[model samples]
Target: MQTKDHKVLVANRGEIAIRIVQACRKLGLAFTCVYTAEDAASGHVRIARELGGDKSLYRVSSYHDANELMAVADDAGATAVHPGYGFFAEDYRFARRVSQRDRKLIFIGPSWRVIRELGDKINTKRLARSLGVPTVPGSDRPIYDEMEAEKVAQSLFEFQEQQGIRKPLVLVKASAGGGGMGIEEVYDIDLFRSVYRRIRNYALRQFKDEGVLIEQRIRDFNHLEVQVVSDRSGRNPVHFGTRNCSIQSTGLQKRIEIAPGFDPSSIEYGFDAAQVLRDITQHSLAMARKVGYDNVGTWEWIVTRDGRPFLMEVNTRIQVENGVSATIARVRGQKGVDIIAEQIRIGLGEPLGYGQEDITFEGVGIEYRLIAEDPDNRFTPWVGRVDGFGWPERPWLAMHTHVPSDDPYDIPTEFDPNLALAIIWGKDLAEARERGVEFLDTLVLEGANNAGEPLRSNVRFLRDNTGRILKF
Candidate 1:
């Protein structure tokens, strides 16, 4: 199918929405964008008006309202919907509605069946184990009965003991919950029952499903992700590469992401870094093929200090850090690979037109998630008006932000306090680290809240972490 025949409704906000608009334009496809009153001052709104004209922009009540989004898509005459990374991006019900509604707009992610199948942590674990993929040692299915849950916890403790783990820990989490909610860690098996009951109650109240999963809590591991892309066929799935997302905040939210996952050339590891990267990618592709995964998704994995990798969960949408991987990727010796554009093209029924062998990687890419927060004070969100925000432009650097430099922008309190995303590329790890520091050192970000206090950011934290990008 030709991409020009389709029009995309960008059902998202901030930097991702901006990128989706650019991606649609890049493919010669018409695009429309949505914004709420709180987000009217965002750069996405400005770019949509400047590039797509007033007719291409719509005012929506909420990003979470499926009905509002559908109405906007219909009003804009959009043939497809692009849920960029958050909100309805991974909602299977929303995806189903887009395909099953009377208008029948295309969902620009995985099929609803794929999302439904992989969204469940237990189901994903079972699928991985069925295909010989390594997963965290514990129950592959949800344990409802208290006796069975305790047994699983005991086994995990014993398993860790057998592996010479001095302090064994077990993780009890809600099967239907995500984003670090409905989870607890038990250091002693004797206290497992109480924690289990608490989480079960919370799960039942919040998710309406008390089914809980028990797994061994692996600590001191590097969080890695494999980027997979495929067309509607799902028969020719390929991987972009891996990214290291270990540098995170206190809440386990990722802050810095580096492409290629590891750097065996610059840092020595206890295990073969190259072999670990290859193994994880191979396993990720195998599972994608098994589930007939189509479109863009992320396979998250946790690698131990000894090089053992365990499959975590699948993010069945384009990720926030996808740009870092794209920065280092080359498809058929071509530069400037845009994964979002490829996702749109493939979602609209276009064939992949390329294979795994045709893809290549070069250089080191690092992405810093600039946020208006106090990194020293528990990473507290800083809500204030940004008086000044500017950074020196460089050939190897790319910035994606919603904060306009020409005007003082007030940070929205209703959403995450993320300011921008700065992606830097270099020939090697050393060069990338140097460039990252340079970018942060020269950044000019100033703001003040209603209380008349100065703004606080994570600039120092990001700069300090840049020197240890790929170290495990």
Candidate 2:
């Protein structure tokens, strides 16, 4: 109903930003990007402009400087700002600044008001509970002191006992935390004070909000999420299948598989995996509709071994693994599935143009994050000039990274650690698993190491973890 020709400013960096740049080009929208001076030579900086993107504004330096970004948007005559996850993506203040009274710049996530409510964990949990969304068993109130934390821990343990879960998994985590930050687990009651103090300090320092909550951490839980897209009208919100990010270790996401995962083993659990998927997808759509959610966001959940799924939180922005959704849509024969482009269109007052009945997915998609780190030697960062790099010459296999070029040896590195992402699709999980191995085997990262000892990359780890990528 409210459609306008829009120009967008990508307010982040790295692969996620590049994804947006590609989407803007495909949709024929004028685009701009902000970058730190350190990233002046980055691949995104070059590619975005090549796709008819605006040149960088010489004035803005800091990526997190909301004022400077606002100035850039004004100077570039951009109509919308898409904050790729991290930095100011979830920052409510940045949202408020972008949608301030004067400038008509659209913030391409949630409204600033919704962000204010859901960005804080306590408020989000309360809202989710009110909407009948299943949440973890824990205290409704924020745990502030030792007494409060201990009391909450006891209640959580009691709940765990009732649920027949045997793991001292009482967690005190930051209310305003994401990207695996501001979290601590308590295994011992006597050590509660120390853990509480440490977590509280970290939360205050990192999130600038000491708000913490206690939750019963689901043991052997699988991380899952449903991707949803909405328009300004809010009548046509659609779910773009689901993704399993359980292939993570030590709280870092290493690999992700979409559309019911590549694990046939998970189907052996007591409850039906189909039931779990149905429940999560239904709950996610219900929650988004309840809020009249606009733009694109993800509904994150944690499912136990028994296939019981509980809502974790809503990421109110474009996610890094959104590529999986797009690829899955394509594999299912749904063309033109650019989520970032839709987010911009919704922000600019366009209807979703379709309803849930119009969407479909029938295949598996997996994304392997190519960390510029060694799989052996404790996953140490191995970043430097890439002597040579290559991948399998397959159109079905999609890769997002700064590592390859017309000249394989021309690959440059800024040593930012996360180097690339490889995405592949298959008609089923088995086919998906096989293609993953093929992709990894074909990957050729033959550069001398930064330490000059040996070449290092996660391709080996991914290849080795073939059948067991879910547990990682």
TM-score of each: 0.93, 0.89
Best candidate (score: lDDT): 1
List pairs with backbone clashes in candidate 1: none
| Candidate 1 residue runs with Cα over 4 Å from true position | 138-155, 172-184, 189-214
Give the lDDT of residue 58 in candidate 2.
34
Model 1, 308-411: lDDT tens digits are: 99998899999999999999999998989999999999999999999999999999999999999888997888999999999999999999998999899999
What would the per-residue lDDT of candidate 2 be over residues 1-472, giving only the tens digit for each residue? Answer: 2344677888887788788778777667777887776776666777765665445433357877887777888888888888988878877888887888498688888888767666766677877888787787676656667687888888777777787766666887776665555667788777877888888888888667776788878778788889988887765678888888876535454455565542454435556776777788888888778777777889889988767778888888888888787777742456647777777777777767777777777667788887766656656567565666777678678888854454433223433467688888877777888998888877877666546765567777777766765442
**Residue 78 error, candidate 1, Å:** 0.8
Give lDDT per model, in order. 0.92, 0.73
Identify the candidate with maximal TM-score: 1
**Worst lDDT window (10 residues) for model 2?**
407-416
Total backbone collisions, model 2 = 1
Model 2 scores a TM of 0.89
